[model samples]
Target: MNEMINRRKLLQAGGALIVTFSLPMARAATPAAEKTLSPARVDGFLAVAHDGTVTVYSGKVDLGTGVRTALTQIVADELDVPMNQVTIIEGDTALTPDQGTTSGSFSIQNGGMQLRRAAATARRALLRRAAAQMDRDISTLLIRNGVVTAAGGEGLPIGSLVEPTALALDIEKDAPQKAPGDYTVVGKPVRRLDIPDKVDGRFTFMQDFTVPGMLHGRVVRPSGFGATLVSYDESSIADIPGIVKIVRISNFLGVLAKSEWSAIKAAEQLKVTWSSWSDLPDQSKIWEHVRNTPVVHDDVTSRLGSSRAVLGAAPRKLRSTYDFAIHTHGSIGPSCAVATFTDGKLTCWTASQATHDLRKQLAAMLALSDADVRCVYVEGAGCYGRNGHEDAAADAALLARAAGTPVRVQWMRADEHGWDPKGPPTLLDMRAGVDPQGNLAAWESELFVPDGSATFVPLTGAELAGLNSLGKLSPGGVLNDLSIPYDIPNVTTTAHRLQSTPLRPAWIRSPGRLQNTFANESFLDEIAASIGADPLDIRLQHLEDARGKELLERLAKLSKWRERREPDRNAEVVTGRGLAYVKYELVRTYVGAVADVEINRKTGALAVKRFYVAHDCGQIINPDGLRNQIEGCVVQTVSRILKEEVTFDRSMVTSLDWASYPILTFPEIPEIVIDLIDRPQEVPWGGGEPTCAVVPSAIAGAVFEATGVRLRSVPFTPRKVLAVLRAS
Candidate 1:
């Protein structure tokens, strides 16, 4: 390995970038040659080794999205090999060139496309080579089971023709991808390749990775944001049993021991002093702060006409404010990282989404070259953008480098819950003017928040300064709601960035789309109600595009929503229906409306009996995987809407564990019916996030329909619901 420089900086072309790099040869070949080859693969290799095993390397991570199965199918389809012949290697920094991270629902949308194209090109190259070797026409060479047969029954398996070194094949940069009509395996509902191990408990997540002679480590993260370690007494920990060493490296304090339990226990026993925040900042104050922040661009850069004039002159208008709370990814397994340093090189195994970035960060922290750091994948815990596997992995590497031994660090549930950076609290203030005839004359919304993608971690001193001053700039969030698909005469939305206590945010599943969609969809519901309109009908009235229509059509058909009776008819409970839809990136779009929710009038208990969602994300890779992703989104969103929050007093997190920051258990999980629109020809979109955008709104809307009371904030806990009911 060569010394590693910051390869990331070299790749960034600036401004919300998406990059794709192809190996030279077939994939990047000229258009004339690219078309001459077989068309089953796109961006990856499908080859027979000397031993006759078929290997496929993918640029996308499984991330539990079934990219492994999807990519394998492409290879199997293109190479005319059985599924059993293929072996998939994914998200390893050492072996694979840098594909982008796995976030943004781009795994199959972008990465799958690349792999499919590459595999197709390789299959063609091999067949071309086979024809030459056999002195036969390429068209007549039949490829099946890794063998090529001639018209006269002369045949040879691909493995027989292998050179000492494997022939390298590249993908065409602009090769016309195999369309859905030509797809042999992509759009089908194939079983997952990673499922067997997962079901049999044979899979190894990062937490499961272990090394010979590796010591366990735990870092004493400050208990609060902005809390610095002024001093610590390690004297007490030094005498603890199994303690290997206590070390302070630059800014972090760590304890290394023979076992994870011993290290954690010893570290907990040591008393440390931390600088706490001077004041208490609760949910209300944070929401208020967000609401009061100035709007960045008043005109809101819209194609609509003069919203200001229409809103100001309108005879009657409705305006309201909505709040969203913080939530964690709450992955099934906790976060852990294992790293070893030897010969001035570090090797780490983790299930992180961003391998290239992880390698860079580890290298920089250890003062090593990018080549000196290698990141490989273990099965990962769930990552909702909150999974800090990269941070934990880097921490382990830094600790291992300092202690002169390999280290595995596992974050306890409390440590994971309390210390992980959260999705920022958001505030939306929307005001709309509707004409007497129920036409939306004007609409305006002001959104406030800091940049979610500003830094990998929350801002420190210098980073904080830069972020606060740049708060006037765009904070990089989704804005689908602001742009009404309806041909409204006047509509404008403005976003203002407010520097919050130097906190860093990243792309959670839906990030900007979640809060913005909640506000927009909920407000649209309110507008529909104010006009005495059916929520679905009103939405249909406004939807002008084909994608929007397709989503609505699918949603209506799957939910059987149109034939259902009125929400108020279920007098036993407050039952109502609500709808939400969004276009997340150009690759995929979805529209979903939920039904069946009840709020107990007496005890303030809430029961989401069932939810029906319809999604249209172009091609379906795995029906089961898509369904699982949507269901996971539903469960995750329920946690956010019902009971999960990170509270702070004096900048110190008070809800510190699973007990305090609750996740949705099986008991609380509602029945979710997911329907995928089978438009395989359309661009494939992400399913994980689109459903999340509208969950809170659907719940809130259902509660409103049931009880005529509204939930103005997230985590519509019992107390908030009771308070609203009592007031009503």
Candidate 2:
């Protein structure tokens, strides 16, 4: 591969074709080279090389979720090839087709499903060729592990069949696939191919990549989110070694140097003053501010019959309020990106989840056509939802444009938490009514939130461009519309997306569902307690779906529901068991969780000793990978509920480091037991985010059961726990 793309290669490839040489030799293809070898239609998202090697193109990038392994397994089985024969390519705009963002656990559900069908189609096309060559019927031939055999025992490898002739034919037609029971590779636990590279420090994360002659950049953030740059002294940093240039766009100031340490030193020395704004509301009164803020009511989000009349005429009624504050992504390593601009075109290597959309945004910012700008995906540190990755990419692009050289920009840890959009605060008031039969007759919910926590480009990209495009938010994250899988007579859920605060908000994992489920499930337990019925019996009695019931029942058995319910009553620590259930989207990924807790009365500390999670996300892809996703979700969500919160005053975010915003430590981590529901016949749902919503609810329920205290807020810190205990 030609690793360098200077003036010589720039002129050779011309400006019309995208020039990218980052991929290794096994996957590289120049514009001219691809034109000759490219097929009219993909053999279901796969290509065969002259060397008999196969490469799979996927639009989804792996964020340590193991999509590469699962997608490869699907394609390998359909193509009848061994794992070693398959090479997976992902998130390369110049190479792979667009599959939107790699979020909401849609990679496996949408991209994996599409590839599964594509591989099947490619196999049928190859079989058709074999039938013609052998002069035998296609049905009579057999293929296994990429080798086809005829009735007379004649055999041929599939690599020889994929030629220029096959390239001329479109092979995307629907083809027959093996039944679930006949699958040889799709359902098994396959080790992650990307892990060995990551384990040995060979993986090229976004922060690790270095383009030839690339400059290092470090951005200096302002006092707060809404502050504006007034004046800056450039010569103050002239004494720093290797001070290449100082790029400034309004409040977006950065220092570039030969090395990252030099850039950091220069950035620290350069003093930039910013204008302050009082548009920010009081952070202490955020709960009241959100509740009283002007909000547009959404009546059509979720509704059944007349809930008002049903609840008014019910035999019993209960209501409670739950609040979730804004939280930061708290990535261990801050986000980084590299960009270069030349010949009226720009290219960027980013860790953004939305590459295709990012390309459009960059094109719009630079006044170029979408085709002139290319955004290649590079894996980075943890990003639950719209972190500082995109903003860092924008920063690199601005610096590169000013310097006319490839510049790598990396945000300091403080800049990441201080400026990165946060997961918005949510306030929910849940009301429920029950009949004499102990079944829910009416359920009404009111959820109040800021302009939703979904992806807000203006929040990050527009801010980098000095444009405040914060009038309204996206529709993805304001999931105030909460419903239950259990049967109900009259149900109504209303979502109020209020005007946003000065702090811009974006998506983080499950978003409103986590807070909403905590409120809904806790309220359900309150109703059960009012009637003196076991929470399990109430849930089982109301559960109409057989799948939902099975999930809860299995979790109960795993947690030893009856034997350990009371926890011996006189243990060293207050012991209790509790359960929570939810179906993400009210239709996808049914989850039931049970938690066993031991609370220290004197210290007001809550320890979740063990957990049982029953998850049904349709068919299983990789059992180990699914377990990994669930385990991560459980741990991270517990951290959010117990120790994580983004605190800010009127001036700036005060909680800038790990000391101010501590997460659940290793000692706090509990033993997690997972039960995966594998139904290969059903289409697979998302595995990454659904299980997170119920974790908080289960833990809170157990805490309440242990001490007879109803805790509404999250991050059950000692202070908050003691306050509730004292009030009781």
> Best by lDDT, which number?
2
Which 10-residue span in candidate 1 carries the lowest summed lDDT?
10-19
* Per-residue lDDT of model 2, residues 1-728, tens digit only: 34444533432221212222223222211212342212235632567664446777677878778888999888888777888888876666656667778888889998887777767777787889888988889998877877888878888788777775563345454568767887788889988888898889888788787777789998887776677888899889888889898877766777889998999999888888878855667887888888788886554456788888989988888888988878888887798988888766787888888876677677766677776777777788777867878778878877888788889988887888787777877788888888777667888888887654433455354565565433236534557326666677788888777866546676778877788888888888888888887878888988888888998888888777766645543454798878999888777888889988888877788888888999999899899899989999998888998888888887778788889989888988889999899989998898899888998889888988898888788778888887888888
lDDT of each: 0.68, 0.77
* Candidate 2: residue 310 Cα off by (Å): 2.3
TM-score of each: 0.88, 0.93
Worst window of 10 by summed lDDT in candidate 2? 22-31
Clashes of each: 22, 4
User: For residue 564, what is the lDDT in candidate 1?
Assistant: 68
User: lDDT (0-100) at residue 178 of candidate 1?
Assistant: 52
* CA lDDT for candidate 1: 0.68
Off by over 4 Å in 2: 1-44, 165-173, 436-438, 452-456, 459-461, 467-472, 567-572
Mark the regions of model 1 whose C-alpha exceeds 4 Å error after superposition: 1-47, 151-153, 164-167, 174-184, 292-301, 458-482, 567-572, 585-587
- CA shift of 572, model 2, Å: 6.7
Task: Summarize candidate 1's per-residue lDDT along 663-700 as a digit string, tens digits.
Answer: 77788889998777777766666676778877888888
